[model samples]
Target: MFTLGTYQVHFLTFWCFLKVKRKDRWRNGSKKKFQSQVDRETEFLDVQESDQKLNFKLKGPEGEIQQGTCRYLIGAGGAHSAVRKSLGLKFEGGDYNNEFMLGDVHVKSPQRMKGLHAFFTKEGILAFFPFDDSGNFRVIYGDFKNFDAAKKDLTLEELQFKVDQVGPKGIVLSDPSWLSRFRIHHRMAPCFQMGSIFLAGDAAHIHSPIGGQGMNTGIQDALSLCFKIYLNLRRGAPFELLKGYEQERLPIAKDVLRATDLATQFALSNSLSTRMVKKWLLPFLIEHTPLQKKMAETISQLAISRRDQKIRSNLKIQYP
Candidate 1:
């Protein structure tokens, strides 16, 4: 848990679960105002277009279509957007093959477990985060492919079982607010910009939640693109100026994806080799100040560079 000013903040390292009073969750009226603004700004347009160059028909949700010459397009629909049907963007990546269950529960315990706690069991990774003024806990559990099979609305007995499995037994809960199933995917768009259209956020990259980099990376993507676009618009640059967005962002996304994939693999590994590595080698490395400092620098993102030559050099150092 992290503290800022008068309010206390909790960090759930195991999974992402955030809870606040249903009313106080957002600033007094922020939710309503935000929703109203979203409702007003959102327009679901059905665009149908004939891509004469690709010899394809493009249709949107409402069946409205546009027919025109093909120039350039950017796909920012995110990981869920179908490549073939939507933007014809190729998505190539692997799934984690593990399942994670998360929930929000109200508890009466005085001993609050704060920070990101992980329980590495024979079954999988079970994690918990604390939320709300009433000591509600956000729980994440399971690591096997069958993890979702265990995700039915958890009965009180079932919830107790999970708590017992992850932490010291005898902890009790009074209420559960939310529950859901999730899987990890390590994927990035093969290319960020094809012609004119560019991909950002989940559309450009997807990875395990291990390091909380998903949103950060997406924000970086937005910032990077905004800078480029602003410069291009100010200078009346050609559309090709957008290509640098892809070239610069794609490799960073790929590097993040690779690092996250390794983290997930480490978390899920149970083999004798990994057990030895984790139980012995990992502790030693983490205890060393130099190694720890390097890791800290990497996670802080201060180590990443955007200069083309510097990027190439860092890639060689990290990946090679």
Candidate 2:
């Protein structure tokens, strides 16, 4: 991934084929954002609405309960968000049938490990991503068929098997730091705001892991929500300021989900014709300079815009 500036661009990772998350960056940044309120486990139990106030019941690990009332609540809970569930908001998409295995392992590769590499064969698709200067690589094995069987946990030997099957011959996977099997979903909440509670991040939308836009989109939601709330409370702006948060972000989420779905479909293609297209057509398309620049911007999420959108505080915001 990359961040383009006027004169210089920062290469966040060598992987452009797929977007990868750097947990350390998120953890450190979040720590700096909420300096004092760091180690709290907040279990949201219920949200009650009475008169004009919304009361939230939260439970702690020790069974301690607390209640707080606010005019607005922002639900940043991840996928399967309780807040969105309480509001009866359903995600709008289905899970992909294919399953993928991901793991971070110490790998020694003969080929240049600086950039992301995808080995596509009739067997399956296996991609390796080098995260840092170290040889620690994130490997993904895509199984478009045998969904049920592929859902099983990945073993070290199984990782080796997959590597031998699709990855470069000399590359060796060992000393895995993390391993898991998962199925990806593409879903977005119909509406971001209901009453006074607003859904953000995974609570709002989720898509294939291809572009890794999930967390980035959610962080954008938090920033927009916070700024709107700040304006309404501190500057005596109308609550309509918050409506722009949804108007601006929801479409961006939809576009991201669409992009991810397309990329994932191409990556996980199993049919002969699709495989040929992926093998030949895709590389040809990506070779074009203009298309390459556009893909970079789209993958980096620099193309999302809301120039024509207007902020309206009169928009209905439910609190319960």
Candidate 3:
């Protein structure tokens, strides 16, 4: 499922844009069945937001300068977002010491299809995730100390060795497709909005990818923000309605950071506390139906909503 997940995320964010741009031009000079609806313009050079308006300085494909204005700005850019930086938003937290290595390899496993396996060894943490339904797997191993030692390119033989050392007996990995190493970081912009400007995805917050919520969280931000903006524009709602976007999302980002950090710490450490929880507490908790249901909803982001927030959706919004 790793490849499938990766493809879905990419298609949603990037491929969709490319397809829109190339729509009718690709097949022939003839007209297309469906006309592109979005007015996409690229080469954004600078942006400034203030007094309920956004001023953008753009560079065209031919390198000509242009300027435009809008009532709102949404920064979907990844980490190092220029919009967040220009607005002087604070991003708390830094990179953790742990480093993780991942590889896509053909694996022989007796494990059930789509089963996810995680192993905490003295060497660190090892995890196996199905890459697809075709018998390939994504293997990952990492910790703080080994993260530094694992900087260099890891050979296929070395990857197999590491898997053999940490993985369950009888499973073998070979025919590698890709390998890479990365570090975990937990960063959050305390506020998801500043004046008429807003941030989403990695721009608003980023955390350990343990639960696979990184992309999903960003997409959620976009969808939630868009929904609110639609109400403000089409339904004659006040501009202040946009504030709920940040109010709803920032807290979720904080919660995901906390959850992922706890999971990462527990998996990478062999402390007495971790060992006790891993050996006994974890299994017991997993058996609890209510806790499992809660976890399932959280992981799926289905539990995310503003129903509990004191701010009501129909509250009168005063524009600044």
Candidate 4:
């Protein structure tokens, strides 16, 4: 049993088309079916554990229930929308008090550019990610706790005021297609598995989407969980084999949560000292070659290392 929406994807391709194609032709059909049918709103209610199988219920919107039992269960419900208590897993993590506002905006700008622009200012951090189109952009503003207090249906004037509070001059917002407020969080479950039932994606871990890692990490979790299940099915392995998945993946998830938590804090810090550090000191430090290289690697997710490498290398060395 696997909750959907935790599959690995090619970022560039997925962002461009919002679709994922399986690398294996045989798997493509099943993948498409899963993608088409999975419901994000449906919640997993509970998993009843037994000696040889696990029984679970998925509750639909109208109180309808779907009952199922399987030898294995994979919980990929996601970090924010996790059904952990229903699955009998323990979660451990903290929250970042900072809130952020994000939306897509249409702008007529004096400057034409592609790529991401980040503004670190006395008010907060504002970032603009240009879309494939020239006039459309994804804008993000951070550090305003009462962001919700602003106009709910943000008018063009309100949006422009918010943007101007954080950046260079002459940036105007003509129209906004989407807008929403979010709080940053960094947390992970203490365990990713309990017996035959396993947690994946946000259910097991959650972090700030600062480096665009939340979705990516969740997708990787799904891939890893699927691989482990496939191996167990092929080898007729005991459910004990699945425990290794949690042991291996949980630490990595914790690391990601920690890093993203720091990034969120740094992005939203509004204290006078932090403002000075971010606006003035950070850029100066980043100007150094080594610091720039390190920052690049960190944001690119190149710094994470799976314990599998050590396991593989040790096995090879011992065998040789």
Local distance difference test values of all predictions, in order: 0.60, 0.74, 0.70, 0.64
Error of 1 at 306 (Å): 3.0
Candidate 4 lowest-lDDT run of ten: 1-10
Q: Which candidate is the best by lDDT?
A: 2
Q: Output the lDDT of residue 147, model 3.
A: 56
Model 1 lDDT, residue 168, Cα: 52
**Per-residue alpha-carbon lDDT of model 3 for 45-64, expressed as tens digits?**
67886566789876766778
Can you give the lDDT of residue 274 in candidate 3?
Answer: 74
What does candidate 1's lDDT look like per residue over 173-272, in tens digits? 6676666667778877677764445678888789987766887688678766765565456545445556777777888888889888898898787676
The candidate with the higher lDDT, 1 or 2, is: 2
Model 2 over residues 182-245: C-alpha lDDT tens digits? 8889999999997678999999999998866777788778877877787678666677667778
Query: Which stretches in model 1 have alpha-carbon errors above 4 Å?
Result: 1-74, 82-85, 104-112, 129-138, 145-160, 173-178, 235-240, 280-284, 308-320
Highest TM-score: which candidate?
2
Off by over 4 Å in 4: 1-30, 33-42, 60-62, 80-82, 144-157, 174-177, 235-241, 287-289, 303-305, 308-320
lDDT of 4 at 239: 56
Give per-model TM-scores: 0.68, 0.85, 0.77, 0.76
Error in Å for residue 39 of model 2: 5.6
Clashing residue pairs found in predicted model 4? 78-202, 78-203, 79-202
Residue pair clashes in candidate 2: 195-317, 195-318, 195-319, 196-318, 196-319, 239-313, 240-312, 240-313
| Whole-structure CA lDDT of model 2 | 0.74
Residue-level lDDT for 88 in candidate 2 = 86
Candidate 1 vs. true structure, TM-score: 0.68
